[model samples]
Target: MFKQKKQQELREICKSRGVSLTPQRQAVMRALAARRDHPTADQLYEDLCRQMPGMSRTTVYRVLETFEKLGLVRKVDSRASKAHYDADTTLHPHLVCLNCGKVVDYQDREFGHLEPPVFTDDGFQIVDYAVTLVGFCRQCRQDPNN
Candidate 1:
């Protein structure tokens, strides 16, 4: 249901923005929306390639870039070197596991709420922001080797 809603939202957004809803774009969005975990483009490509034999890594990277520009997704910040994407673009905090490189939405929405001034002292406009909390996840903490 969540994936369907996101796909519909993507369609509406594409239509409004005068962008063609290409198959690659649709596939990328569907794959991203289907997951709760924030995945890197390479990870997405691996999953997609099994289903879409012809899909390329470059295409996934490009489509994700387009989606980010179109406000269909958000790039999540994590300790990992590769970029991670989240389909849920709303303002919310993320809990990043330092040990396993896992990123998940922080369950408590009210915890990190913030309202910044429109302009900073240097006259830089504050358009957006993200809050990420880093720590070891339960599994990682319980693991003997980690």
Candidate 2:
């Protein structure tokens, strides 16, 4: 039920933005929406390749780029070298595991209430922001070796 509603919302958003909702685009959106792990383009490509055998890695990259530009997705920076994509565009925090390279969503009212620092003195206009807390995850903490 949620997926269907999201699909409709996506279609409406695309229409408003004059973006074409191609089959490939929809497939990519669904793939991102289905996972909250903030997967990289290659990860998404790998998963979709089994179903879309002919889909190229370049196409996946391009689709994700388009989605990011359309504000349908967010490109999150992680400890990993590659950038990860998030389908949820809402303003929220992320908990990144330094050891396992895992990314998890984090929500804190106090953090959300904090105001953005003033940077106008430096001629920087803060349009938006995101907070990411980095630390060891439960699995890593349990391992004595780590």
Candidate 3:
């Protein structure tokens, strides 16, 4: 969860984007930001429903998509059947557990040793690329190995 100051800053961002700080949207953002577990839209909605009564599952899903476009959040890649919401904006790779399907962050000096590959675009610009590293988390390696 972000500090009060960061929450206020997020609110300001919404205002500047001309996006209303509706109760539903606010609740959804708060829930996602409060958690680092990288929850799916449905999971997020379940949490929001408890805090903000009458919150629609669809609203939670749509609001998240809007915030993603506004750069307030990101979709964390996972082996799970659904997408996950991530508030961290730092550039880093992820290690996905095959057994429990957990997502772990990874940053290595080796990654910095090589320059990123580049390709010319016909017209559109390429801003950036995310490097996702897939592997088993320590928790998944315990006991019987899969």
Candidate 4:
């Protein structure tokens, strides 16, 4: 149901923006929405390759970039070198595992509420923000090797 809603939202957004809702774009959106865990472009491409035999990694990367620009998805911040993506665009906290590079939404949305001024003393605008709490996940903490 969540994936379906996101897909529909994508359609509406593309229509309003005068962008073509390409099959590759829809597939990328669906794949991202379907996963609960934040995944890198490579991970998404791997999953998509199975469903879309001829899909290329470059295509997935490009599609994700477009989605991010369209505000249909968000690029999550993590310690990992690779970029992680989240389908949910709402401002919220995330729990990032330093050991395994796992990124999960912090269940409590009110944990790090902030009200920043529109412009700083230097005239730098505050358009967006992210709150990420770093720590080892339950599994990583339990496993000695992790």
Q: How does each model score on lDDT? A: 0.93, 0.84, 0.74, 0.94
User: Ranking by TM-score, best first?
Assistant: 4, 1, 2, 3
- Positional deviation of residue 110's Cα in model 3 after best superposition, in angstroms: 8.1
Q: Is candidate 3 or candidate 4 better by lDDT?
A: 4
Question: TM-scores of all models?
Answer: 0.93, 0.85, 0.80, 0.94
Index of the highest-lDDT prediction? 4
Error (Å) of candidate 3 at residue 84 is 0.7
In Å, residue 41's CA in model 4 sits off its true spot by 0.8
Please name the candidate that would achieve the greatest TM-score relative to the true structure: 4
Model 1: per-residue Cα lDDT over 30-66, one tens digit each: 9999888999999999999999999999999999999
How good is model 4 by TM-score?
0.94
Better of 2 and 3 by lDDT: 2
Stretches of candidate 1 exceeding 4 Å from the true structure: 144-146
lDDT-based ranking: 4, 1, 2, 3
Across 1-146, the per-residue lDDT of candidate 4 in tens digits comes to 99999999999999999999999999999999999899999999999999999899999999999999989999998978999999999898999999899999999998987988999999999999999999999999899486
lDDT of 3: 0.74
- lDDT, candidate 3, 1-146, per-residue tens: 37454467569988898888887777777787788777889888888888887888888889889888988777876767888778776566776776777775665735624354465556555566666667667666675464
Q: Considering only N, C-alpha and C atoms within 3 Å, which residue pairs clash in candidate 2?
A: none
Give the runs in model 3 whose Cα sits over 4 Å from its true position: 1-6, 107-124, 143-146
Candidate no. 3 TM-score: 0.80
Instruction: Tell me which of candidates 2 and 3 scores higher on TM-score.
Output: 2
| Model 4, runs deviating above 4 Å | none
